[model samples]
Target: MAAAAVSSAKRSLRAELKQRLRALSAEERLRQSHLLTQKVIAHSQYQNSKRISIFLSMQDEIDTEEIIKDIFKQGKICFIPRYRFQSNHMDMVKLASPEEISSLPKTSWNIHQPGEGDVREEALSTESQREKETWLLITKWLRNETEEGVKTWQAQPLLLKCQSN
Candidate 1:
């Protein structure tokens, strides 16, 4: 009974906090979001690794350009996720330039994407949806594995759309 009460109180507190945060103004939300992202990057555990694999967050609209650039600056190799329709998951690809990933297309729930291409060119958008702006990426870790002829270390799968055959 004591544990149950504690859990109930915690849930109530959490709900109240969520409600208050949701009531924040759009500008305030953006500011808070930026700060949170900065904090996460600052305290990230993978900072000095030789390679880092980051499965980009789909739900969050945080821009990873600066972070990607920073990774390159550290002389680390990074990778992002590419969705394959033939298989039901994402395939990892090494990133060459931070500026190359111009825009990420929403291909699935919480999954936005920028494909591998030349660093000087931008990824063309094939969709008209405005809410689909965030892109999912997978960074390289210490090593890579060749599974079934595809490369991966630790990354997730499909976003929404399948790769064109």
Candidate 2:
């Protein structure tokens, strides 16, 4: 009974949040995305790493276009996700350049990812001292298998949080 109630509450919360997101003006959404992108770029996690992984944003989410471009611009290695819906598996595959992003195929979920057969070096399989992810709507700092912490500016998408994060 408790589990059922918890699930119901979760669903309700998700619905309410999504409705609120939909209510946001397009201009406001874009402005927030731009600010968050700048914050991620200026983040120390981004500055020191040679290789980085990030998500391709959805329409309703914070845009990552600038961040991805900046990765290539700074001459750092970039990795994007390739998800397998059939199983609980996701790989961070190396991306060649910013231009290649558009050519990649889009999944049914409307996310762009490399083709199944397209072989790219998996971040974990490589020998790297640091691996980090700047998520679609959140920025996380990870150290190997253990999570160091997740910092999400999306939770409170405001100009005030931008300076601190």
Candidate 3:
């Protein structure tokens, strides 16, 4: 009963926050998103990382397009999660350019995801074993795995958080 209640409360909070985010004006959203991107780009972890795993932003979330562009410009590899419905798993797909993203089909959720024929690649490769590779993650909120063991950055006051692990 206690667990159920906690879960319900969390769902309610998430819904409310989502509503608030959806209500923001386009200009406000763009401005805030740019600021968030700048903050993430300036972070030492992002500066030093060779590979980054990032999510495609939903309509109400902070936009990641600029960040992705910057990553490519810096010659860093980018990975995005591709959900496989049958196996109920996600595979990281390499995105070489922003144009590649636009060319992909959108999922039912309206987010662009790698479909069949997209070149699948591993975020960590054999070469990465020799050197300690840094990782950066940008998201609206921090999760348990990220919070406990990873270095995370939160873009607070704006209500969206970007994590660098």
Candidate 4:
């Protein structure tokens, strides 16, 4: 009974968050996305990161186009998600260049990603030992603190924490 209640609560919270995200006007979303992109690019963590995993934003999510470009301009290795429709699996693959994005086809999710035929290096591979310890997964959401319970999604203007998993 307790498990059922917890599951129901999760569904309700997710619905509420989705509604909140959808409520954001296009202009407001763009404004916030720009603000976040600027902050992430300027952050010391981003400057230090040699390899980073970043998400391709949906229409409702925070835009990451600027950050993607900055990564290439700085000569940092950037990894983006490539979903395998065969199974419910998504892998972080190396993005060769910013220009590579345009030639890629869009998925049903309205995000540009490499097709299944494309071969790229995976982030979890044993190829690079130096990067084994350093990789940041830049997502649309951010946490106030780690190791402790999350305070909120937008807790900080730019929360550039390293993600090991």
TM-score for each candidate, following the candidate numbering: 0.43, 0.70, 0.71, 0.74
What TM-score would you give candidate 4 relative to the actual structure?
A: 0.74
Give the alpha carbon lDDT tens digit for every residue of 1-165 in model 2.
Answer: 698898899899778766756766788678777777777777766676667777787887667899889989998888789997778488878899989988999999889999888988876565542343333225332223326564322422221111101
Tens digit per residue, CA lDDT, model 1, 27-107: 654564465445435643444344444455432233445667766787866566667666755555555666655556556
lDDT of 3 by residue, 1-165 (tens): 698898899999989878767766788678778878887788777887777777788877888888889989999888887887778677656787888988889887787898866666655543543354536474554323364585433343221222322
Better of 1 and 3 by lDDT: 3
Best by TM-score: 4
Which candidate, 2 or 3, has the higher TM-score? 3
TM-score of 3: 0.71
In model 2, residue pairs whose N, Cα or C atoms come closer than 3 Å (at least 3 residues apart or on different chains), thus clashing, are none
**Over 4 Å off, model 1:** 1-29, 55-60, 103-165
Candidate 4, position 45, lDDT: 77
C-alpha lDDT of candidate 4 relative to the true structure: 0.75
Q: What's model 4's lDDT at 164?
A: 39
